[model samples]
Target: MTRKTKPSTAAAVQMPLKEAEAGKETNCDEDKPSDHPKERDNNVKDNDGTKPAAEWKLPRKKALLQFRCKLEDAIRGDYLLGRSYWSLSRLSRENMSSASSQPLPLMDIRLWGVPLLPSKGHEGTDYVLTKFLKARNYKVGEAFEMLQETLWWRRQHRVDETTGEAPLGPDELVLRTMYVRSVDREGRPLCYHVYGALEDREVYKRALGTKERVEEFKSWAVQFMERVARRLSFKDGGVDSVVQITDLKNMRSRSAKEARGVLRSTFLMVQDHYPELVHRHIILNVPLWYYTFHLLLLRLLHQSDKSKFILARPAKVTKTLLKFIDPEDLPVEYGGLLRENDEEFSNLDKVSEVFVGGNTTKSIRIPIAEAGSTVVWDLTVVGWDVSYKEEFMPEDEGSYRVTLNRSKKLRESVRNSYYINEPGELVITVRNPTFKKKRVLYRTKFKPTVPMYVFFKS
Candidate 1:
């Protein structure tokens, strides 16, 4: 659901490149003062010979031309032109008239050597293109090159098709830590990722041992981003950005190291490939060591990237979260109203249990008592990582399909509700992959049918 705007036919204003290249030197008499009487008298006479105040004004047409020229000159003089200035200048001038007249062909819209076309159902390619252009300081060639590289990388890894594929057992552990739960007040999707919840180093390394597996993981990451992006709609009142919340509670030294290993690549992918997609990044429960590590990371980011990050400690987490998200949409763990026992969830029934084990897997089969029913679960893990999943085995001959897959390490909880499409066996599995025994708590509920909305006229 990419945002779309009606294309404007107005010509893009062109900046004067020549004047920008050659800096303007203003002659001011205030800078040069002579002590001699003769020089002072001569300066006064010259000033007297200057045009009168009323005569200094030009005709309306001439004045407009002059204003346009000055505007161009100001833009040109403000920023230094880099190596790609010439390419940008030529492209801007050549396309100025045509861009004003009609829509440009998607294939012809080249950013460097890569062709940039609007995604299906998204007609705001030009709008997104402008963002990349601004990010690179309007250097078309440089922006295009960066965009091209990202597109090429995406193609090499088959990022577009990642949503349909299944993650390996081990990879599922990492994927579960990052979750896209719901949307914010402005319709921007809210994504939560717990950095401290990554698996052990050896286990993670083993999971990503091969290059193909590494690419697969990267593809999964991109797919997660695409899921967030797909929720955006730019139809007039629609939002075109996402809000990310990074929870750093219970982070240890080992977790820091693991987080650092993956964060750089993740940041690079987001900044380079998906510029301007993130509206706000709220970091909750930041650790002391995080400041030192964050400072180092800041050196690699653009200044604009630095501004989007909002860091808050435990004391201010609630206030900070409330500023950007409504209380209803915010999770109860972060001092919001969405949780078990809350009014919204009060009507739902619950089945609660606590399991303790190591290197053991637990399975729960929830029989679909009736079609059109709903299955909901809330799971939490303590002290270790757990691989969790949900599958549907059809009563007929169809193959089983995985509805949910994830792995989490932190003490955080996961809640999900699914509407049963067909009468089938709903299987829930949780596996403790670590050597140390860990505690896992879960609550599940099944409804005969999902509730429908009801309204009454006033």
Candidate 2:
């Protein structure tokens, strides 16, 4: 008879799954409508006594686009992409709700259980995922604890370079192993087993050098794991506690296929064995996407010893960098400081341009049928937005000049703030503030559908 262990401290027992699926608004895979001013602000009372939620609703096209954009931003900001351990693509309303709600403690009965889905044949009533195991009077807690202990053992596996034998922990601990075979002098392959143990000083590589040594290692490994399992009240049901096989021979023959099979099996197995724990830890697996840009900057800064650049006043450096890149040919394109007669700028001519606003030009125009709805335009430029989300630039007089088209100037001058929906032609001129003879012009034809946000870093 198995001696049952008490409930696991790591598993929660009481939070029902129903509360995890609420507060979710399902989308039909269609674009969400854009909001009017009041709607965008959650229909709050406007300071100017504008329209209320009952009086304002967003346009279908605008809402859809905005939602799509926000979703995209969320994905990008979170770095939910390739090789991420967290499967953001697997996110659902239930998962999102479960994360937001107050979670129960480990002692709660709901911790080891999962709320059954309506379609899961528990129609009209909620069921715990582990209820079936409970009905069989099996000590699920013991099984769970044993699994955790096994993983902990695996995680702690290490060996000393000099020890030829496995070392034991202070207490009895479980271990796993595999068996493999080798070829004999007659060219006949003889089978042997190998052991993967925690703190096993005898590394398998040296032990498996000969067929006889290999068999000896495998025999010891199987016996060791079996001993641990028996001590933990675990029985070797039918399958072998460990497998024996030649590693290099098998791996080389089917690398790709084996890898795919292992990946698929591991994911499903993890979900089956520890669904709740897996869900909570999934976010940790996600790649830190936003850090990529920051990392790149830091790397470049280190490589160039540009530490002083990052320390400069944000406002000064920000504007300078902005004006530098705001041109058709980036300031960097001029290749740092230029000779008085560089061939690159030989064909370039300076032109007279007016600067009314800051570095950003308000040349785009987007018309809205309603006065309250928010308007935005899409500019495909990568990492060009003025939002602080991007790297900081310097603020300088000679760095960059922004000009607005005549129409946009008229609008912003009258309204103080201009909103555009479509792109309009605008010219940006960069000149040598002192020499004033060497200059470059950048023409932007892209417009933004979203409200453009500009900030001074300093």
Q: Which candidate is the best by TM-score?
A: 1
lDDT of 2 by residue, 1-458 (tens): 99998542111111211222342323212222211111111222211234421232334223322322332332334431222213322432334344433222221211111111212112111212221222222244333333333323332231111123455221222123332122111111112211123223333334444556544443344343333222210001111111112111112212223222332333333233322111111000112332343354445322212222222121232233233222212222111121223342321332122332335422222223333222221121212222111111113444432333232111000111223332222222221223122222222112233443534433
Please give the distance, in angstroms, between residue 53's alpha carbon in candidate 1 and its true position after superposition: 39
Output the number of the lDDT-best candidate: 1
Query: Candidate 1 overall Cα lDDT vs. reference?
Result: 0.54
lDDT of 1 at 276: 68
**Cα lDDT for residue 5, model 2?**
82
lDDT of 1 by residue, 1-458 (tens): 99988432111221221222244322323322112111111111101134321233334223323333332332344322223434544554564464343322322332222223322112233334544544564455566566556655654454543444555235466565677654565556678876545445565565455666566556656777765555444222235557788887776655456455456667677778877677777889887887887888888887767777889986567668867765445665775545644532431234355574778888767777566778776655544367777677667677566566554444346677777767777777778877876555455666666445423433
**Per-prediction tally of clashes:** 2, 47
Give all TM-scores, in the order shown: 0.48, 0.16
